[model samples]
Target: RKGITKVTVEALPAEACRVTFELKRPWRWTPGCHVHAYLPAYSLWSSHPFSIAWAESKPKAQPLEIEMEKIASKNGSLSHSADIDHRPNIVTADSTYSRKSMLGAPTVTTISEVAHRKDGVNIAIPRDSAVTSVSLIMRARTGMTRKLYEKASASKTGTLTTWGAIEGPYGGHDSMTSYGTVILFAGGVGITHCVGFVHHLMLQYQAGTSSTQKILLVWSVPNTEALEWVRVWMDQILRMDGRRDVLRIQLFITKPRHRGEVISNTGSVQMFPGRCNPETILKREMAERIGAMGVTVCGPGPFADGVRGAARSVVTEGVVDFIEEAFTY
Candidate 1:
């Protein structure tokens, strides 16, 4: 499971990151399914894991993509080098270290080559809001590898030894195939799950086998640039849908450079130039919009809690159904 085959720069949010890989023979995955991503080695045998962010349905094309944020690292110095920003370090038989020592420090050891494989587990990304399928958002730690840590050039994510992991396509509580509407809320990496889930749902809607679920996406990010990664794809999808009146997209920037920059002022979405904790969401009219819609939340705990609390009040009235996918600890 330790091998490096190719590295490429792909699109995502506001950032484009270097995606390195070595797909094993017969590598397989679905469009929304993600695998455990491991960084280069640290010591002789250590690596970190992150989610395989792109759709893996097609086996003929590139298999991975990392949505890189374009911000330069402020921590690339001999003194700041002490930070575990980026370093290729994966766990292997030859690798040796402890949890404490590897916490902030991860070192990379170059190999002649790298190889990777699945332990035999594949997951299906949610394609519909059916009772049988669930939309889950779980998070795990992954080390930043050396490719991300560029002391000379600060465009890449700081290289580290580890990153994050994901759970499964496990089920969630929703009405059914004819839910009629799907609205998703995502902040930061939470957008990861939203992106996959929306792709799945929309595809079903277009096939005529499912209800024409109106899609409303409200994404809370720090800036518009963050949307750059998926901009191209979203544009393509939007053009294909030809149902603008039904699709309402709101991009909420919690840290906009100018004032009054919310994508829309009437919806549950609001733009701010500061933080977007659960408290900020609590202060909004999310409950009203959530009424009669299948509201799904994926973000940190606080944000999820905020969504849950607001929806709980309305759910008792049978206005909407709320499902939260905690993307972080």
Candidate 2:
């Protein structure tokens, strides 16, 4: 069913935005799954897939409460919360992007330099509400994503609440609860896929529903600003019951804006400078072997390949399984 974009916040790092939408109907999905969004406003035939970031625990009569610090704006103009790039690009005068072709056959303009094929939008919906709401964190790439960014930039409040449709809560089926040690690796916005698994597994471990005892979430990003992408959700996960007992998060920032941005908390949550070496991390994880280890990765092709390679190199070690999430359309 169609969902209404209720709130949109220009997330930090200048390349992304956090959007909230209220679904017309109620739906439940596994944490690591995703949803496809078809924006009729852009083009009906072109649908984008996004992971489900956060969801409501139980149905609620009230809308999900979103608590984010409002970004300042001057004269009610597009606030800092909105990062709009008004730079005009050279589009072929051909009918490629024309309304006729968009209707007859979906075609999108490709800008090689600035274009990054977005995996999909991630959503967090409230439970029990007559109208369910979801928050989507999007990075402006090319075509539809660029259009969405421009539209929001043109908004006075920097909000891009609009009419859109969602399809399927796909691919969260792999259950890691049977394993004793679970390691998740995420890159950039790929963190959306792993966030739900962390939440679900923590709850399962806390309630003693499954055998999972150790969950190590390793997230790699470009800079500190990129960290803002999942800050809100991470804050919530940190407070979950027995979270400290089962979760260990290692954040890797390849580029730091300044030396001060490279702070580490030591044990539970630690921040490191530069990229991570999969082999080193995997070997260390093996040294502290808990039980059977399940390694899952959701990120760029290179990162996924690296994780797979590392896991394969150590197959001789106890029970180690590797799962990779690839939503290639």
Candidate 3:
């Protein structure tokens, strides 16, 4: 947990970026787990928590993926220095300073400049990966994240390798193996969580280790760029063994680049335009119930609540469990 890792940064659309961390040692985690990252140099010694987006167990392979979003710091400097974004003097939600201090000028900073900070974009962890190898998909916002983004963008090559620290592959304990039908719902980056489960369950089903006979993955993203968030991972899952036989994926793009871009495959994978209606999708799946169904949601509060309500309405239809994976800090 105290090892230093090398990170490669690649920018993505929607002000987002991906950071691939190469661990110096081995690491392990379950599908829903996360890790705490301590970028002491970039973040004023503050450690932030982010969900592990992807991981692998191969020897010498990078094993942890963390998706990050850049948050704007209120009074941070944007001078573009490698070590200039640490704003420990500002008042924040968790700071000891009172609310009045938050409304006034930062006691330590006289100049107001835009700087990027890091924020966690909640997502899923890849299954069966060594704790040491990982990747992070993140969006650039204000202080540390912005600095990181600028550094990556300014890189002569497409990648920027830097030093980073990782701790704790935490909280992926929920399991869906006991259910015969498993339905997963995701919104935006939340699809990251569901994608790993799809891989885990599919492999288990193929090996006769899981009771899940049917798996349905429903994901809602804003646009094609957002789709790129999990394009590589989804591509891999689509090609998994017996994927078409046991798995079905439905992608709903709330905002499409073009109406024609909302395409669909005739088989197990389908794409549609507009937001996903939780109740409607739940009702349809419950109508064609398999064995004991498990409904898991990882997204916004409103969306999760809608799914929870939908799952409850159909409880009498069969044995259904609605598991929500969400946290606030």
Q: Candidates' TM-scores?
A: 0.55, 0.74, 0.75
Cα miss at 118, model 3 (Å)? 38
Best by TM-score: 3
Candidate 1: C-alpha lDDT: 0.44
lDDT of 2 by residue, 1-329 (tens): 55544444453345776765566666665667778877777766788888877665324353222211122233465454567544434432221111122565433222111122221222232221222655566777888777787777677776656677777767877768889999999988888878878877876775688799889999998876666667766655665657767888888988776565576634677778899888889999998868999999988899989999999988898899998887345
Candidate 2 overall Cα lDDT vs. reference?
0.69
- In model 1, the runs with Cα more than 4 Å from the true position are 1-34, 41-52, 56-178, 260-292
Error of 2 at 187 (Å): 0.8
Using lDDT as the measure, the top candidate is 2
How do all the candidates rank in terms of TM-score, highest first? 3, 2, 1
Q: lDDT by residue for model 1 over 1-329, one digit each (tens)?
A: 33443433332334434243423332333323433443343223443333344443223433221211112233333343344344333533221110122445432211111122221211232333212111222222223433343321253643222322223323333323345666677776577656655655555555666564566666777765555445433443443343343455556577664553333333322234555443344334333343245767877677677767766665555546677765633
Model 3 stretches astray by more than 4 angstroms: 61-131
lDDT of each: 0.44, 0.69, 0.68
Candidate 2 wrong stretches, greater than 4 Å: 1-12, 57-131, 153-156
Candidates 1 and 2, the one with greater lDDT: 2
